[model samples]
Target: MSDPSRHPPTQAALGILFLILATAFFAVLDTSVKYVGAFVPVLMAVWFRYMFHAVVVTAVMLPLRGRSLLRTAHPRFQVLRGSLLLAVSAISFVALQYMPVGEFTAIVMITPLVVTLLAALFLRERVSALRWVLVTGGFAGALLVVQPGGNVIGWASLLPLVMVFTYAWFQILTSKMARTEDPMTMHFYTGWVGALLSSLVLPVVWKTIPDAGTFAILCLIGLMGTVGHFLLILAFKRTQASTLTPYLYGQIGFAMFCGWLVFGHVPGQLELIGIAMIVLCGATASWLTARDRRLPVEPPEA
Candidate 1:
């Protein structure tokens, strides 16, 4: 009977736990995308992922929110947001083709840095000097993680950097739109826009049709990925960003384990150090962002 809008204190505390669970399963989706990419064009793999996502979202929305899930006030903003997500997903799937999941994921941790900078430049938000310092440190950390030109596992490790930067811009847009939009409107558009956009060019890009087993794998990817984002959005709505930010590091472990178990991809010394720096920067930036958000709040009234 409790309104989810005013989440209980304990519910806020559980946000990170839910985020960690979502991240773990989400990592599996990423690994599966890479697995399918091996047998099909990355674009084709992305196409199927979104189609499955569309089917799942469409079916669920009918029973849950019905026509509300089909409504949104701002179509243009939704289009841009959906486009950004599709780009990030496509870039990431392509990047994973030759990159180890651990290395790809570590580079992705720096996306917060990119988001911080974008927030300052485009959204005109104030970012303290200390946060800038952390962002710079994060850049250096990413270089360490990639260790370019070395006899690394594969030079493709840096490809996810493309996704990170795109995602940074995407997050900034989301932040700006968050004030004007309801979460339901935002969520529905995400699935619908991305699915429709991909479906357009999918016929041109799709090379191989999936087998029955591979089709099932694609379905899993779609369901898990959509569920992961839904859980993430729910978690953030329930708690302070600072409260859940630190737990995203748990994603690294899950990503690495998936790589190890499924692909035998293990990190070498330099990559591990890079992962550490990425972790440090991620934690620091998250702490700073959270602290800033909480600073303007007045004490609760009696």
Candidate 2:
């Protein structure tokens, strides 16, 4: 039976579509990350991305939101949120150095299972048998995609895994914050904090600045990322999280396309099969989650 208490109804129509598009933009942003990573350290790429994102966030927020935008009553939470983002970005860029963008993105699709497991273990929430099955299948698909024993697997495969665990944690934090703050305020803190943390870190590992073309690409990376996040907000605002979650798997397809177009990289038949497994696992998980959320609860021992 669906747990009405556990799930909320879809927010709005536009928000759902925006979230879908947001995932697409995120895939594109990742492609840019890989393209630029070809010439520089992934950390350098991460640094430039956050720096440019900060500028865009600040510029856009200034006139519309004014100084009011800076007023986050919860500084500690804001910092924590940013710190999570920093870790994810840092790990991801580092991982990109060792793997293609598509492979990295493919691995990240396992996050749904991570979130489910974490919620059950840490939050003491009940997980359905069906959901657990989906998580297991998703991970099995991940291993197939990774094929640790195969030539395709490398130490870098671990980066996206790190990204997965951290991102899952980040989403948990966001879920908590969503109850207490406005979306814009949440976005403000998220961008500003990431920008600040990356700024401080970039100088320490500091290599030479990127050339103009590379720098420009980095800026485009920033823009796409910002749009991607904002699209998430839009999607959530219009539809329930459950409604938007399914579209996330679309990133794999986008990742595949981006991989081919940006780097002339093509997945082998096995990876293609892995992608199919991931798609099935992802779809089943989403449907199960949404289905579970929609089912009516039965009173125990009534």
Candidate 3:
């Protein structure tokens, strides 16, 4: 007889669809950030994003989980993780001011590659030679996307690289925390931590919204970010990370579409090739990871 307590097999297709929707929401969030970046101070824009995120999560989650919503075994690590992610968002917004969204996201996608290296170094995970080769190719792809000799090369181009490294560490912390914390609890802390930290600096950088339209856009930024992250959590719950990791590359397509539709920018040939390399390498690395865990691996198209 089937054990009623055992969880059912993961719904891979549903997970992929959730991930795609998450990506679309993220793309819209970025578009909103880039749009508001023109009118608001970067710090203020970031503050509103997090402040509203905290408010929304609290309103929804606190009622459901009550005091348990604030429970965490490692509070310091949670704060640091949220702070690092805040930094990534702030830096990315600044970079978006000067770069196209698609290219910036392509660069940020290197976080997976960096995470592989960090896992080997810090987590002491066994990485095979083939995976190492894939990581190396991912770096090459990043270089192609950056193109030091090309016009796209500038200080702004470096911001996403910084964000990626910080994000890699953030992911490591998240991996650790996921072992002991409820996803909703973690999400709650992320929003509050970011909101609280940014509030500390708001006194020096506050900017008033000049109109209702801009205020509405600011709210949209928070709504999209909160919803996107929630969808991502839901996606992971439905499938193995390895099964879902490859579909993350789908973000590139969504980002590209949003960039062109909003800004009339299309990636150049070299940039497109670089994106392909990064996606392929990252997907392979994720597959190897799943295989190491003895989980069933699926193709990118699957």
Candidate 4:
């Protein structure tokens, strides 16, 4: 990885651009998953996502990295990391089925706050008072988005909260493994682990495609996910994660746009305010985290 301190300002600018594009792609992936969920079993859709991602990544990366692409210093941790992500994806797919993309996204955006709580509790990390305030404020924002009596209320609303927890753990494990593992290798295992594990239950969830259009959309989901992560890797290579952290909130805006464009769904006033609060608090918390450690923070993949 190139040191962010050594990079020219133009490189950081390019990294920001890449990160924004990557977020857009993720928004598209979420929208596509929501659309396809209506026509297919959620499990089947999840399988296609990982299957396509695993195959495409293997095809492109194997030749470039050779057997080294499959090498890993911590095989068990890699599997555990991949399983956590699969849980995240499964929760996301099911949650999107019951909730609007924009609101669901805002709730999942509380991941950094959850990560902070987990680190302080389980990792024995010290938490400053200000960081605790940011974490509380971030969750408060999430409550505004999923407030009682809203359309998203009921058991469905808890789905994204569950996703936030699962994804936070995923981010934590990735940060630990990144210290010694090749990122590309970890990426490879993640895809295959998700694909292979999901495949075990595919026999029951398998269903005939209703049409070519549905099939195409499935392919689009895979393409968006694979390309989005690839761009993220490229972006981090060009600039420091702290330099790019603020821009990560761009996904919330993109998700709102996608929800409105596809479903004519717009967030209510409180929901919008809630979303803004999440963006503000989450970004500030990330900045503080990077500042305290003086190391590149591993970003949330969702």
Top lDDT hit: 4
Which window of 10 residues has the lowest lDDT sum in candidate 1? 293-302
> By the lDDT metric, which is better: model 1 or model 3?
3
How good is model 4 by TM-score?
0.97
Query: What is the per-residue lDDT of model 2 for residues 1-302, given as tens digits with 9 covering 90 to 100?
Result: 22323445443556556766777788788888777877766776777667776777778877998878777667798789878987888887776666766777777776667778888899988888978888888888777778786764467666677788888887678667655666677677777777777777676767675588987887777888777877765565455545556676777777778888988989788777777777787666655655565321100000
Q: What is the C-alpha lDDT of each candidate?
A: 0.74, 0.70, 0.78, 0.86
Off by over 4 Å in 2: 1-16, 287-302
Q: Tell me, by TM-score, which candidate is best.
A: 4
Please provide, for model 3 over 1-302, each residue's C-alpha lDDT reduced to its tens digit, 9 standing for 90 to 100. Answer: 12212435546677778888888888887877888888888888899889988999999889888999888899998889789888888888787887778877777776767878888898787777887899899988988888875776477678778888787888777777777888788888889899999999999988788899999988888888888877787676677666677777777788889899988999999998998998898777766665464222221110
| Ordered list by TM-score, greatest first | 4, 3, 1, 2
What range of 10 consecutive residues in model 2 has the weakest lDDT sum?
Answer: 293-302
C-alpha-based local distance difference test score of model 4: 0.86
Angstrom error of the Cα, residue 114, model 4: value is: 0.7
Query: For residues 191-210, what per-residue lDDT tens digits would candidate 1 score against the true structure?
Result: 77778888888878877555
Q: Please provide TM-scores, in order, for all candidate models, with all chains considered together.
A: 0.88, 0.86, 0.90, 0.97
Clashes (backbone N, CA, C under 3 Å), per candidate, total: 0, 10, 0, 0
Which regions of candidate 3 deviate over 4 angstroms? 1-11, 290-302
Prediction 1 TM-score vs. true? 0.88
The residue-by-residue lDDT of candidate 4 on 1-302, one tens digit each, is 66876999999999989899998998998988899998989888889889988999999999999999988889999999999999999888998898888888888878888889999999998888988999999999998998866676588888889889889888888888889999899889999999999999999999998999999998998889888999898898898777888888888889999999998999989998999899888889887766665334544444
Candidate 3 at 69: error in angstroms? 1.2
